[model samples]
Target: MAQNRDDDANDGSNGTSNRTSGIINSGRRGLMQGAGLGAALSLLGGVSGAGGLISTAQAAEAAFPQHKKWKIVFVNHVTTNPFFVPTQYGIQDACAMFGMDYQWTGSATSDAGEMVRAVNSAIAAKADAIAVPIVDPNAFDKPIQAALDAGIPVFAYNADAPRGKSNPRLAYIGQDLYLSGYQMGERIASLVDSGMVALFIATPGQLNIQPRLDGASDAIKKSGKKIDIQTVATGATVNEELSKIKSFYLGHQDLKGMFAVDAGSTQGVAQVMKESGLPSKGVHGGGFDLLPQTIQLIHEGFLDFTIDQQPYVQGFYTVMEAFVFLASGGLVGPANINTGLKFVTKDTVEPYLNTSTRYEGKTTKPQIVPMKGAIKS
Candidate 1:
């Protein structure tokens, strides 16, 4: 499978490419020209060019030079999910770029308690920084505060605490899940005309996906259409999700649309839609994230579209924010970073399927692909 290539490509090995080596050498040369060998060597932590495209070593004379390899602990809600594979790669890339280490630990089953425990453990360890997806609104509030009190910088990624909630996490580095879902709901309203729509969510009431479900529901309802929205829960496992989706389709043969809020559930929706030939029957479907299967299925006309929340940046930016906060000694306070949401449909999935790189969680080999045509938004 394509994902197997992705997994093998990014097996956490520090294998350097010629391109990266060249970039590093260039950065080192620049440092040497500006300072003596000792100074340059000291500055040799990590360097980068515009857009962080060129991997460089760190500057030794950094503003916050403790000589200690700051470790960032990332507590995940679903650590093993393919949707987060690119995210983990992002964290890895950022850590390497910034001369830091990171640990990925959390519940593979999306258990909030397990995630909370991971956060608490990071605090107890007095980690340099902590990054987590605030999957549960209240469960993370106190633990996050504890981390803050312990002097460990905490940042939210992918999922965040709900708005107006006094969770004292410094900032959020992810897409606005609710607004994205609301826009998606508006998209669905444009496509489907007042029929039963089945929206599948892997887990409900979890902040990671609940807001999306709520937003989509609200938007569809606000459309003032007689669209019947029936939500079904697809279990954690991909197999279970697929089975549930198929079962739901079998029961609701007249479903006008099938949508999902998560990656596994989204793929399940596509599989069932393809198997049932729902698109031919004028049934619409789409959801968030770009699972390889989800992209391929969209290309094949089985699925209509998928939203790209840029999962890679969720991790990348979280680490970046944490580094800035730690480096600036709280002078650079954290801010909510919306990673952005984009719609990928048949017309735009070509690049995704054709390219393989860490940016999309596809490959570890870091070579820039040259673009030929004018870009369209």
Candidate 2:
């Protein structure tokens, strides 16, 4: 597994320039190896059984040349958040597969200034590529452009700049944040007829989540229901989010529903719902992410349904995109990827509660999970 480098003055460079000559040379070497083996195998009329399988695998490997262990820098808005544990695991798995390395560094408190500095650090380090969550619309534009100007491919993951806004990142790999929120809002409207409903957000204007909040509010407003939506700002940390959620519920005991746009606040919503026994009182609660506690609460009937944005794929696909761009020496164009959104209800939460795997950031041990039933779409 590749180790995650922290923010430090010493860049990970060991006398390597940002040149594609090494990659091209490696490709030529692989091509020679493939040509020699392919001609020999053809003369021998190929092998059979296990020998044939090994030969095929070797040929496939030869097709994709292995170059220098490229390093990609991932600048996140919340570096230590549990929601990204699986995301990091995805980064690790992808890096291992692609023979690459990555550094995970960013602000622990969603500080845009701090995140910008991290991006600057990565650019200065002469990283092979860079990925970041564009949490702040304008703050990342300059840094992304700078990275691109330095011959480093920059990608946006988890969050992207607002639509119609220009940002120089190559691609975005994450769920459709605004659409997911609108869909969740529709769910909320369906669950609650009319009353005061609270929506909590970790940060009010952050691009990563603010669109979700905006979408939810718009959906609720369009529902034409008498529901009163109150937007609450919960601090970045989990403990602070929990406290604020609890306090909100205490003051709005008569609220019809409670939901959140982010992971931590969603977990906090579930906790409050359970502690206050709000579900038994016909109060619906739900939010996003697959935090262990969130899954458990959903299974326990405390939360109606929590949305899954496939955080693991967000990291995995971003790395894959970066790898292709680097391996191709800028020939392969990276395209935007929507990770996807799925609502996890009580019926669908069983698997999540039963399994503890790196896919969900539950365990570090890697193993293929057995499937016993028909797959859900």
Candidate 3:
């Protein structure tokens, strides 16, 4: 599959908007009609499992069987990320526990074209359910439509399509990216003084992380601090990210804060900030997800905060939802599932240190810390 490599840095573009465009074949246009108005919904009853997100499926009246064997496809953005290790574990574990067959595949990066192909391949294999990270609003319209049209239940997990984009991806099973951004910005506000802030992202306008960048931008702007915001893109490589952060800082040494919207760039941002001898103020830093490195940076006092979108829940629930909906008669919309959000900081990172979080590294079972009240919101 061809890839679209765009610099996601907010240097020229504020990344406050999703500016991606691609043509959805006319035949598939109608599939993009499903959207929401934040209507009055009350599915609070009969909710079971983590975060009250299991289900109230039409099969709510019928007792759910303990064993179900269905095939599910999980299309992720960064398939190799350790942040996804637990997510994958969650999906695989849930599939085993629920008696479902699951396959995990996605591009190494947030390439919408690659993800669309993965979804199509899953459909071609006649998957019973599909879970995707709707990273590109324009790019995913057709494939998402195709899945739904094939009588397959598709759910958007982790990153969602831009709000009101008319993508037909059944329901969203991930964090409220923008709200997490707002919370990240709030934490940054507490750490940085009045000055310029650098917003680092992997690929702007891709799908999942852009909403978070936009959210954080809005919140930081709302803070009434004389903060000049600059967006910088880190091409999808760890060394590239480290170099980019170093370059941005070398060029603009006065930047007061650095906000990274992805995990890889978060660590880079912190490393560069530390090497530049910038305090948490002169270059206050915050980011998304908790990789071991990002957490280590936070402990070493290089990063002010990083949002935890509960990636494990994303992995666990995406499978659970797909499994339940496949067995049930209909879809599991807001009427059923909800992916949660949590912005983690120094005050909150301790509890997570020992919790069964989604940041399981290779060859390491997630360690649990039997404590609470460390990270701030």
Candidate 4:
């Protein structure tokens, strides 16, 4: 819901506000000296109060040029999913910094057609830029090209087209899905030497998560282990995912491990692992995202780990790319950005459990989170 706000009031603490204030104060002093408005505005072009000049490119790096407020439309596959809360916050924070606005629109379920329609709508409305998760390989290609044809930049976030596939989206800002999944599989192999494991997915074959499944399966196969992997398709909603996971566990009590790739499914695996007391039975469990419950379950030693895909940066960086492209009049090209993946185990999940901030979509209040010790990679 925070993403729905058309205009977010500045708290005057961000760099953008400070820079604008400094510019204004400098302008006032220049005006008092009869230097005129042009001389005052020249400060943005790297003119110092001491009369030193800097290159225009250097000035561009420090401050953006004056421009109209741009609007970005983010078309998502699951508009109301809890996993994307921090992602929307990222969009909001970046947009606020650049004085831009964004609209969060898409299907509540993982409906590629609905998401495609939303993309078309954004293009039709002449949005300054557009962002969307290319959940369907081909569904979004035409719409993205249409947006680009209209001189509007399009960026992909959360999900991307399959590798080596050409879609018109300028860049991708999200995790390296297959690599993350392969690494997860490696972790799974380390945990359970050889046994039955259940891998739950919210939606099967969706570009957003299918690659992870494929990668995990391939990794397990490549390991040449006796692990039996049963891939289950859990529904899109959290409750449905939980029920499906529970049902699968009920049917296969001999499962040695439980895991998932999506947020809701991962949380479901944690829940089922705890409810069934599977960890006590030597059942290893893990998945992805930073859902509060998943973090707690890991802290409690029920789930082995949850991969952190840094969802917030997915939205924030996508907006950053869009902003620079729009601000520079297409001179700055959009490039693929991997937000990154980190394993949040019990040993490393304390900060996640202790802190509640907009950065993690835990709370709406904005504040700098304090660092207490050495940062872990």
Output the lDDT of residue 253, model 4.
92
Estimate candidate 3's alpha-carbon lDDT, on a 0 to 1 scale: 0.66
- lDDT string, candidate 3, 284-359, tens digits: 7778777766777777777777777777678677776675555455643423245556666676666555544324
Judging by TM-score against the true structure, name the best candidate: 1
Q: 1-377 in candidate 1: lDDT tens per residue?
A: 01123446447622211111222221121222223346655544455456653333444233233434567888887766777777877877666555567788888788999989988988888889998988887888889989888888898888888877877888888889999999999999988888899999998888888899999999999999999999999878788899899998999898899999998899999988888888999999999889888999999999989999998888877877776666666876578999998999999999999988888877766566888699977
Lowest lDDT 10-residue stretch of candidate 2: 9-18
lDDT of 2 at 24: 28
The parts of candidate 1 lying over 4 Å away from their true place are: 1-10, 13-54, 58-66
Whole-model lDDT per candidate: 0.79, 0.81, 0.66, 0.79
Q: Candidate 3: how large is its RMSD?
A: 11.1
Residue 348 in model 2: lDDT? 91
RMSD of each: 6.0, 6.7, 11.1, 7.6
List clashing residue pairs in candidate 4: none
**1 or 3, greater by TM-score:** 1
Please state the error at residue 375 of candidate 1 in Å. Answer: 2.3
Clash count for candidate 2 is: 0
Cα-based lDDT at residue 128, candidate 3 = 87
Better of 1 and 4 by TM-score: 1
Winning model by lDDT? 2
Which 10 successive residues of model 1 have the least lDDT summed?
17-26
Clash pairs, candidate 2, are none
Per-residue alpha-carbon lDDT of model 4 for 1-377, expressed as tens digits? 01121122223222111212221221111110124235535555444534665432333334544566677888888776777777777877776655567788888888888888888888888989988998888888898998999998999998999999999889999999999999999889888889899999989988889999988888988899999999999988888888899999999999899999998999999998888899889999999998888999999999999999988889888877887777667877688998998999999999999987878877767677788999799
